[model samples]
Target: MSNEQAWEAVVVSKSRAPLDGSNLYRRVTVRHDDGPEEKIRVAREAWKQIEVGDRVMKEAGQDPRRA
Candidate 1:
């Protein structure tokens, strides 16, 4: 991650689904700064803090954070 760049994206959607039985998998679909829409798996708390239209930032090794 030496060449990591900080970039921002807009959250378009969020979802959660069962992972196995009791656990769940959460994800968010974002429109990137570079012009692509991508779905990224995120932690429960992070997912909770995010909403559609929120801007998120990604800086290499770090997980995307609400901006």
Candidate 2:
């Protein structure tokens, strides 16, 4: 596969789970080919910001924005 194809296949899995007797939490995994994966936990509010930022970035050709 080409570099771009490999890059596209880079696994970035996102999921969420509820905390016992508390609000739900989110987890994001960023993995590289044959390398260790990075996991992060974020609260709901922070997760919203992340989701919004991702959408805007994708729509704007992955450009950063001030909001």
Candidate 3:
């Protein structure tokens, strides 16, 4: 993968789970642009901004962004 290129994918599912018995961890499952399923961890705000069927993109070193 090229650092300058971004991977674009569609959201398949989203979830939130408990961490350390108190904190919440948010994640999204996506059908990747390259044809594999991957889970991406996201910030609370970003997770709220996405839903099933929403589009997202990921750069080499950053969190997924809503598209």
Candidate 4:
């Protein structure tokens, strides 16, 4: 995938769970502009940066961003 292309999506829901002992994993469900909803795993720090209803730019296998 091209790194320059970021898909636009809206944060729909978020959940957190323990991953690999002390590390925490955040899962977020996002609705994309093209009409599909996806569940993506993200860093806890990145998850903390977003909220439901927030619009973000999502790159494949990368953290979401607001722009």
- Displacement of residue 1 (Cα, Å) in model 4 is 8.4
Q: After superposition, how far is residue 18 of candidate 4 from its true place, in Å?
A: 2.4
Per-residue lDDT tens digits for candidate 2, residues 1-67, read 2212322112256678776658676765544345665555545664555542142111122322112
Better of 1 and 4 by lDDT: 1
Give the clashing residue pairs of candidate 2, or none: none
lDDT of 4 by residue, 13-39 (tens): 989878678977788889988889988
Model 2 regions more than 4 Å off? 1-11, 32-34, 49-67
Error of 4 at 67 (Å): 2.9
Stretches off by above 4 angstroms in model 1 are: 1-6, 19-22
The residue pairs that clash in candidate 3, if any, are: none
- After superposing candidate 4 on the true structure, give the runs of residues whose Cα lies further than 4 Å from its correct spot: 1-5, 19-22, 59-62
Prediction 3 global C-alpha lDDT: 0.87
Q: Quantify all predictions' global Cα lDDT against the true fold.
A: 0.86, 0.43, 0.87, 0.79
> Worst lDDT window (10 residues) for model 1?
1-10
Candidate 1, 3: how far from true, in Å?
12
The TM-score of candidate 1 is 0.82
Return the candidate ranking by TM-score, descending. Answer: 1, 3, 4, 2
- For model 4 the local lDDT of residue 6 reads 68
Please say which candidate is ahead in TM-score: 2 or 4.
4
Residue 46 lDDT in candidate 2: 45
TM-score, every prediction? 0.82, 0.40, 0.81, 0.72
